[model samples]
Target: MAARVWRDPVLWLAFGFGSGLAPVAPGTFGTLPGVVLAALLGLLAPAIGVPLWAVVLLALIVLTPIGIGLCGAASRRLGVHDHGGIVFDEIVGVLIPFLLVPVTPWTLLLAFLWFRLFDVVKPWPIRWLDRHVSGGWGIMVDDLLAGVFALAAVGLSVHFWPG
Candidate 1:
């Protein structure tokens, strides 16, 4: 399958640097790199005395445009247009919760499951975006919406039990 997606770096990135290559639950596995990134950023942010939330938000701001580019180009190259292998969008979604919620093991698990739920279920507007949006926006917007939902739910938990 390398021939299918090996030609382009953007495709490689959009595939989560090969995390999306898993045969089962590609989307779920594809999110691993993002989780790893969130964990690392959580560790590093405190070293610099920066708030974890601030670091996550900054990553979203910086990486999103790049994700858009990668997702769009990769979709075109794969010609599947939001193929299961194109999971950089899920990473972006997972990152959203990391913006406000600290990346603990429990929180990471919650973020992962919750983001996957929203992404798979695609409730209301999330589904709407998935159906209506096209290209990179199409690929990334729904997952970003999932991230927002996850952020809200996890944010509430963080507030209630901010240990």
Candidate 2:
């Protein structure tokens, strides 16, 4: 099973390119790819004559559905519901807060921390959705909501603090 998972392309993606395979803090490790992705998008924006926020948003739009499918399929393949090893959701989740926001080392760190907090803490509706929803949507929605929560928090912080 482990060998099969490692060999499968879909599983490879669902595992956040193996970051999700970490012995501890899989989600944190999974989120690192998102950080790298966000940074790459940020760098690409200027060269493409696009805004950073736009580039990130476009990526999220593209990746969210793919993450959902990859997560769902991987979960089915593993015969587990939202397996911890499937971190595509985490990859997608971390991108939400960075959307429409300035990308800086500080902001990226804050987004990562905030997204992780909301994801792990699973507040209110996020928790509710996580428990009730099923399949790919089930696996993906909670983290998306967590990302929204983090986005709000990050937005507020940036607004009042204005660093």
Error of 2 at 123 (Å): 0.3
Worst 10 residues of 1 by lDDT: 1-10
User: Which portions of model 2 show Cα errors greater than 4 Å?
Assistant: 160-163
Query: All models: lDDT?
Result: 0.86, 0.87
How many pairs of residues collide in each model? 0, 0
Candidate 1 wrongly placed segments (more than 4 Å) = 3-7, 159-163
Residue-level error in angstroms, candidate 1, position 7: 4.9
Per-residue accuracy of model 2 over 123-154 as CA lDDT, tens digit each: 99999999999899899999989989988988
Q: Give the number of the best model, judged by lDDT.
A: 2
TM-score of 2: 0.94
Cα lDDT tens digits for candidate 1, 40-84: 998989999999989888989988888888898988877788999
